[model samples]
Target: MTFVTKIRLQSGNRPALDRIVDEIRSTAERKGAELRGPHSAPPERLSVPQYKSTAGDEHRQFRSWDYTVYTREMEIVGHNELARQVTEFDFPDGVHVEAELKQVEQMA
Candidate 1:
């Protein structure tokens, strides 16, 4: 059987985020896991205060990210460690991080 883990991390620090992405990729490789998606794909969401707006109406911007990682059931490890490191890792000024983890099992 194969298993996968979906991880979501939020960091105001862009440099830290960049480094962790690489570290996670390396960790997954050492643990014989497959990581999908981009190392850093930035998606911005635009929202306006009023539902109806005309031309030249400015809106708020929100940023989010998406990533997919794969790993075998028995060979899985260090996800929490990475998350911990990410949380505590220091970066340039005005930076912070939050992480979320989800485990999934493939149906046989």
Candidate 2:
């Protein structure tokens, strides 16, 4: 039996996210976890602005901006133990985290 652990991390602190993702990947590989794509979601959408055309405006266009981000995913062979390990995974300061466990298989 196996389970896939989906880890959702929030935006902000790009460098920290990069380092953490790399570390997690390395650790998971060393531990023989069959992991899939981290599948990093797009940056956090923070602001959107709209302005009417002005006489001297260089350009007239609405704009939207977002903060960049990173995402990581890991596989778990032993559901319980892996869940515990995931909980203990190092998270950068001020970063938000959420996890969802999907059952991939069931062993008799």
How high is the CA lDDT of each candidate model?
Answer: 0.45, 0.64
Give the TM-score of each candidate.
Answer: 0.40, 0.63
Best by TM-score: 2
Off by over 4 Å in 1: 39-108
lDDT of 2 by residue, 1-108 (tens): 566677766647877877766776676677777656566766655564555565535376566554545554544444456556766887879567787887777757
Q: How far is 51's C-alpha from truth in model 2 (Å)? A: 20
True lDDT of residue 3, candidate 2: 64
Clashes of each: 0, 0
Clash pairs, candidate 2, are none
Lowest summed lDDT over 10 consecutive residues: which window, candidate 1?
Answer: 68-77
